[model samples]
Target: MSKTAEEVKRIEEPYVCSKKERLGHALGVLGHDGANTMRGYTMPFLTDILQLPAPFLMILTTLGQVLDAFTDISMGVIADRTRSKWGRFRPWVLRAGPLFCIFMALSFLKLPIGVVGMCAFAGFMYIATGSFAFTAVDIPFWSLPAAMTSNTKERSEIIGGTTTCSSMIIGLTGIVVPLALSAFGKFEWTSYFFTAAIIAVFAICMYLTSFKLVREHVVPDDSVKFSLKLGLKSIFTNQPLLCVQIANVFFLLSIILRSYLNYYYCTYNLGNLSLAAVLSTINTIGMVSGALLFTIFSKRIGKRNCLFISALVCLTSNLVLYFSGWSNVILLFTCAAITTVAIGFGYVCVNAMIADTIEYGEWKTGQRNEAMITSTRCFVTKCVGALASVLVLSSISLTGFVPQATEQTLGALNGFHIMYSLLPAITMVLAATPMFFYKLTEKRHAEIMVELAARKEKKENK
Candidate 1:
């Protein structure tokens, strides 16, 4: 047999993980996603329901997210150093879930304070929910996949399964929130508060349940004491993690920019706001499908190839959509669906790739910084999302868009097209660029795991 065939055979060895445990770990994000959905409502709630100034909302959100991104790194360091009986990362989901959800609930309250005071209150809630509370859970929760199992295929399954579950949560919220909003009527502050509270409750329950079910099977060696400098070095020196981070930022940028413009595209360019719902439904379906298919795709083409191909597909679809124009509504929806599926598939690929880097870092640095490496996922996401929102919002303001107007100006329409099609294409090109530099293949990762396992066993016998 060829050496390549032998390596593939060796790495396919099974790792033990029960369905219940996998379910438990996967369930960890229910509350986070639930609360996040409610948080997504904050902008419309503040601007439309509470009638807050756009400038105030802008400054508060942008600042809060930037703060949140920075906090993620620190939280990662803290999680890595944690040595409780409940395990380094699992206990955090239980500890931080309620408080995080509480802040989420509070963010929606219609305070009786004056405009400036209300803005201050909202800012506090925003920062507390995301920067402090969410950061505590996010690093630990994501770090679990690396800790759960060392098997390459199993790790892919775990990450892919979790993403599939998240997409389902998104789909569920997408359906339920609109119905709740319709029943409560438009601009009803009470509706926003009530919905947020319910989501918080649900999130808290899921977090608790996940805490009970998830187990951290892969514990770090106690002999390797925590060093802040070393943890920082581990992150800085890991080329695979850096490449994945840059790629994800641009990938997420394209998705967010297109999403922000969807409403404008439906309302003005397509002359039907209801079609936004159709496109959204397609996007969600695409996400779930891509996530479900990731394990299979990653096995065949490998994770790096999956990332590269997904980005290329997204870029091509967007370019076609841009040049083809929106003459056919059906064609536009098709492109949107295709792009989201690619986005979904690429997201899972990056996460699994990130997990692989944990072992790579350990192999290279002689220190395993799982949470520290995993923290980049949260860091890049928050920072990129916040920055993207600022860019899109600023672009919208410049377009002379008038809310509630029957028609938008030609410039506004053109701007929507650029955001929806052209901008995403550009970002996808950037997203794919980093993939060229991502050199961590599955065979390499498998070899690293073997060497690390041997090192661990030798240390134990001594």
Candidate 2:
């Protein structure tokens, strides 16, 4: 017999769990995507492998990411309105997972026929198309956690674990990629493609493993209508969600800047491309360790407080890095390590807070739209990323970065330092300011959940 809406709503027992197992499952999904074959590999390829000019490369990458912002949100709406035998988000993840992997692998292929401009165009299109497929899987994958469990502590642990594992995988890639390139005695585009292929395979395996370990709660039919107008309205009307979204925009922008500059810093200033990978690995380790610690602390101090604290730590670390003398690699590493930890700590709380906001929406409007909420998060993230790419590339132009210069002048080196250090530090401080107003406490969340449960029961009885 086909299950009625009431029966589906009644089957809530599947959401229960110990924090550890839930964390593991969440980590699996995050690691699969976060090492992010599309993201971690693509931009570098465009800059280094294709040898596209910085300005043009930035424009293409930014446009593609901006397009993804819209695509991700739209996919979220579709997922929210969807009904499938495998529940709301999981079926989409399962269906899109392999295709995403395939496209990621294909995106690395360089064409022989195209001259510089044509090759650049082809590469940009390939990445943009692959990113679209990625959004199809990513939107719902993130949204699933909101529907997974209502316990705030468990949610924090889950998010924390996921972020930690993802960072670790990313860190491992930093070390592995350079070593692989050196080992193969290759510096041409083929090395880049081969490395991407290896990562793609790993990502696919991890995603399938995650799919097997994780399960989704059935979404109620009472969720919001999946319309563009409605999605925008909901986001604007939800104050707490909006604040978090804004903060995430700044946070992600800072991350993009850091990523774009890290390569420049290593290659030009530090005089070692390999050091970029080592620094990235160290940064990832700091992130993993911080996430684990944050999960422990969140149990005692709560998510909101933890977020505030992490933000403070991040702000302080950035400031320290920005002002310290250029010769101090140890000081820079210390600050970077601190900031990485802050990001790890803050990310878990941010995600849990988003899940909490979903409950708040359900309580107020009697609508559960996990996909839309997740998409809202993605929208802000992508916009920030797009903006950061523009800023990085534009700054490169403004600072007179001569990419082909045999010897980098002192002025060019200084410009790179300022972009890498001072700019991101300033932005991160701004990002931390809005969190003071976020008001979702554990008591408040429990109250909201109770009211939502009552509303569900009333609708079922009717």
Candidate 3:
């Protein structure tokens, strides 16, 4: 082979991440999903206990995303500027643990205060955790693997491990939260917080542990300082980053909407709330299984190819549910399981692709803006999650949904069908389209690294 090809092959060996490190990295996602079980109870409790209108509840969600989106951008810019012995992201994760624990727990604990309407309660909690508290932790936490290693295979493995672990947590939460709340009953507000508090304790401990085990390998050049304006501008210029962001934001919305819709689907349509556990448990299991399989495929093939397979899975699964009219219980659970598996695959691919974009940005622009890159990722996720809330809740409102009613009208049932099956299928397919344009294959990334290293060496000699 050519001398250039030989040199590129030689440089690739050091970047592959080890198994122990991948496991450590996976532990970090628990910080987000630890309390995820309790999170499943939020909407149900809002309705039965507080009797809040669906529209107003969505207003709180949308407002939080709008208000907190600024924090994502600002945090990204600030993290880029951070200097410490522990590295840029490590300090942020370790420092933010206590605040995340406190605010997240308080958001669940401080509910239904006297004279404060359910509207006020919902507003307070959603903004407190989603916008202000956890946003700090999320941006830095997800940014680590990118900083840890540049190898595509290892990065996919790390992200897949995280996704699988999160699915396991969500699955457990799905089963436990409903059973706990049923035991606590509708009026038992105090009991709900007890569950959340438990989740917080475990969540915080795991987060801190993950931070300690993590070691940042990508050290940026400290001599340069970048304004938030420039950092944001740099992101727009990176095509692959935008492609992944667009696709992922919509993909996030599709799954969250389905998740939010599950309660209504099980309660109103099927007339049994307990079935949510069964469905969620099945879906989460499928997700964990799918992620493990894709992690293997990602190493053999490529990230974009794996992503296409996932998108196809979502599209097909969604279509089956839509055609079934969201009515058949057997089909509903079966399709949800299949679709969730695809979502699991997408989760790993998107994360690995995001890390790859960091390298792309540094190569094209000569700036290692890891925080800026990751922070926008968090912003898109939060913002889309907020928008999904607005859209899904607004559809319910338009259908004339009656909170806490014994039975919803046919119109509302149809709304559930649309939200749960139809829209997700459409968006799932739409999310796949932009992904086709992502061009940074594994081979290209290796060459970019070789080029980046040479550039650094040449500058140092001068």
Candidate 4:
């Protein structure tokens, strides 16, 4: 337990995961992100396809996010304490696949074309799935990694696999969804419905394989009882956790806002909506590459340093994009690709760092509330995601942009650039600032793991 380098080096071997666990974990994350990719269309789908007002769409999405903020932790607390033969978190993860598939498909269904009926029906379905049903799966799903293994490299592999898989799915979604819609000859309910069915089936298969074969190595103590106040308060006491949450909010805000604006950037700025697919594919490739590269980068430079580097890359790309993207498509794609890659790197670092925080929390707080800890992860994502939605709504209203319009005014175009560039530039910097306060180094985390192992061993022997 010394701070000696020799001790740190000798403490753990190079943990080689089996092919089954590695592949299964990757598929599980892919399924989770794919379902979200399908449901996450609430703002874009309603505005683009249904021609709903941004304000109207905003209310539904914001409400869902707000409700989800509260319920996410509640679900985490419940999952953390549950005693089941299948295990605490796995049961929830196992059931989420089919539920989301059904709900996501229904949300995309071409209900009778009346405005009021469509709004109520789709809104309910969207909220039901996004806020309630999906969180049931998401909180526990992310929680599983911390419980699965205490080895830092092994955790990175799990998080890295998830990040890479999710990025690939998102990249493919950008390419796939548009192509699917093109086949229908126009954007309509049919496009979404058919596409959702395919995504749903594949996602279900991914989840089934993950839980059925792959294993979780760390399980929560059955002795820890669930408490609403204790679960809520734990978030504040964990300094490293708080630091991670703050950084995550800003970083994810930048990511989501850029994604929303990319549609407009490609359609109006590039003058061809279909080019969105091309640019998306580029970003996707870049992101997957970045995630892979950062896997090595974090090992060399440390996770916090890698994250700061990611922020710098994103800021530079957005700054370039804002000043010059309107004039050239090549610059736009190149910078966009760079931005996605940076974002992908950041995602991997943060995910792995969060897993470390779970151990840090248990070491310091004497409790490892994986479900609650990971719940904050989801809550920050949704919370910032809500703000990004608002940023879009305000941009739409401020720009005097009309939904389903064939074209937009110059002012509206500038607004898109501001969001796509200036705003994210600011958030990217903010994301990095908090990483400075994150004090959990790799050596420190390894020491914590060794001590925690000794503590557990002492407990079992008694």
Candidate 5:
């Protein structure tokens, strides 16, 4: 054997996390999911509870997302360059998690001001929660799995477990929030604030606990200094990360629109607001079940196949729901269940694929920007959310949707159907389109890791 081949054969040891650390990571996700569940209700809260105009809320959220785009990149660069005893990602997660929860709860507050004043306050809080607080916490939290382990299987399990755990808790929130609001007399501003406050408290506790429990294992290379130019270069030059972002943009669009429109679908179209909670529970079950199934079958089917299958199932189920109409509640529930299961499967695939790209960036460019790539993911997500908000509210305006009305116009109902079903189906097709160009497979990733391990060892030996 050649000397070079022998030298390259020395692979670095994989860092295996303890069960306690894994649990801590999952707990942090539970906190984040709890806070986001409230954000999902922002559209309904502003429209139904505050009686705000759809167009106004749309414009406000879009502005917030625009600001969010800049913050996401800035936070990513900040996180990558961060150095302390606590490590790059953990300090951000620990410090910013509680702030994220607090800002989120504050966004739902009802003031004595007029509509314009309330709008101004809401916009301020929206920027605070999404652009600043959430940006700091989210970029760091998502970057953790890659920093925690180099072992692909371990990272997959970690991400999968956290996602499943988050889905179940979010599902519980779905069940509980409606009941709480109903008991408190339906969409009251005080009730909304109260619910948001409780979630914020719970989230704070989770973040603090996770800070004490988890630790970062994979230290970043201190040699590669982070600059705006380097960050932009990392994003532009890395092909795999770009492809993942493309897929994520459409995927987020479909998912965010569904979340934003779910309240309208349940309340106006189905004539019962409480049913949204029930559907959330059902989706939670479906997602958890689907994630478990993916864990078992992903190795055999491959991640790309999982993505395509999920898109196919989601697209088909949504279209079927659109054509069948909402008269059949049972059918609606069936389709929702099937679609969420596919979502659960697809969620794991996307996260795992993103984690794999961290190594790919390092191998190809000699600079690993885990948090920067994660920030770009956040950027795509916020931009898509902004676009979805505009589309939903524009449709609302066109349909002449009445805020807090018991009865909606036929056009408004049709709009809900399109937003909930047809739009998502079309976007699902777009979401899966980029993955076809994604060439990084498990076998290829394994080879990259081996090469990276060798390169690192050689650098240290020098």
Candidate 6:
């Protein structure tokens, strides 16, 4: 017979472990699933490889992202209902990881087709197919942390450590890719695609290595029917989930805008592509350091409080960036670092908070749907990403950004500045405002867990 919830909780109590083991596991998961590959490669590909007009490229990419929302949510529902000896999340990751890598590599292949036609085809196929695979892997992977341990403080530590490692990978990509392309003495599309393939292989191997090490404590209920309508109903009815979804839309919108504009600011405003690495390095350092520190502080301050503080810091950093003059690279770097740190703290806590909401949902509806919960998060993220892409590109088009211009017109430069600074700053501030209403606390979570354990025990004994 399966162990009782009380017995399982007791056995899982010594949640702390070696840093290297935890970091490896975290990096393995993040490298394979953190959506880092596209961030590192796609924008550059659109700009440098296909040579499609930026506005058109952005519009197409946004549409592709929007299309993925349905796929991600559907996969989540399927995963929650799936039963496998390999575990619900792990098996999907194993099945989907290589496929995702293959698709990612193929997305970069430069077809001899016309730029617009090729880009449209590539964007549609890659985003649609890759998103399905990604959702399959991602839903379960994220849900595993909650199942990994029930200890609140331990969960924070795990999340913080894992997030730090993940941020490091993201940081490395931001810094190294530009440098690597530069070192190759040519920035051909083929070279970038080849490099991504190599890195993706390594990432997939790392993720696979953890398959044997990490264990899932929760099992899927195969008897439960999976229904898209029911899944939507469950998600819409949950208050905390609703709050998180709304907040995430704004949060992701801000981040996506910042990412889309980063290239523009570096290439045109900063006047050096290499500066991307320097900015990325500083931002990444801030993120890593902040995650580490929050891991330590979360043990004392609690996740909600940490999230609130993080929002304040992020808001302040954005204000600094918006107000600071363009020539002030040092100030910009400092603000970027601060902003990264804030985002780091917020990201870890927010994820942990969502995990807690799974228990809340169970308490309310007598169901555990980690995949559904996670997919909701992904849905918000993708929807926001789509909106951001459209906004950024539309703004560029409105400002008369010329494709292949030797230098940007003053109007184009102004558009870039407003996009890089004003748009993100406004959205971030709005995102943080909703967190004040987030009502879950550690004390409440503890009470919920205790009740859940008793309820499960009574049901099992019968």
Using lDDT as the measure, which candidate wins? 5
Tell me the alpha-carbon RMSD of every candidate.
Answer: 2.7, 5.1, 2.5, 2.1, 2.4, 3.9
Clashes of each: 0, 0, 0, 0, 0, 0
Instruction: Please say which candidate is ahead in TM-score: 2 or 6.
Output: 6
CA lDDT for candidate 2: 0.69
Clashes of 1: 0
| lDDT per residue as tens, model 3, 354-450 | 8888878887777778888998888887787778767767766788788767689999888888888888878877788897787878777777778
lDDT of 1 by residue, 1-462 (tens): 123535655755467678988898778777778778667666656655666666666787678777876799889989999999889988888888788888888888887888888878877877888789888887888888777776767877888888888877765665466557657864577887888899989999999998888887777778778888878888889898899889889988887777555545775789865576677688789988888777777878898888888888998999989987877898998998898898888878878788888878888788888899988888887777677667656655788766556678877777778888888889988988988898888777766667766677788899
Q: Cα deviation of 136 in candidate 5 (Å)?
A: 0.9
TM-score of 4: 0.94
**Which pairs of residues clash in candidate 3, taking residues 3 or more apart in a chain or in different chains?**
none
lDDT of each: 0.79, 0.69, 0.76, 0.80, 0.84, 0.70
lDDT of 4 by residue, 1-462 (tens): 765545655665456557777777788977778877767665666777777666677788789887987899888888888777777777877887678777887777766668888788878887888788888888888877666675667767888888898899988887877667667844577778888888888888888888886676666676765666656566777788888889999999998887776666666656666887897799789889999999788879998999899999999998998888577878888888898889888888888888778877778667778889899999889888788888887888888777656688888888888888889999999998887788988877878777876788799999
Tens-digit per-residue lDDT, 330-371, candidate 6: 898888888888787777777777777887887776777778
- Once fitted onto the true fold, the runs of candidate 6 whose alpha carbons sit more than 4 angstroms away are 1-24, 33-35, 38-40, 53-59, 185-187, 221-233, 404-406
Candidate 2 local Cα displacement, residue 94, angstroms: 2.2
- Relative to the true structure, candidate 5 has a C-alpha RMSD (angstroms) of 2.4
Q: Model 5: which residue pairs collide?
A: none
TM-scores of all candidate predictions against the true structure: 0.92, 0.88, 0.92, 0.94, 0.95, 0.89
Model 2: weakest 10-residue lDDT segment is 4-13
- Give the higher-TM-score candidate: 1 or 4: 4
Deviation (Å) of 401 in candidate 4: 1.4
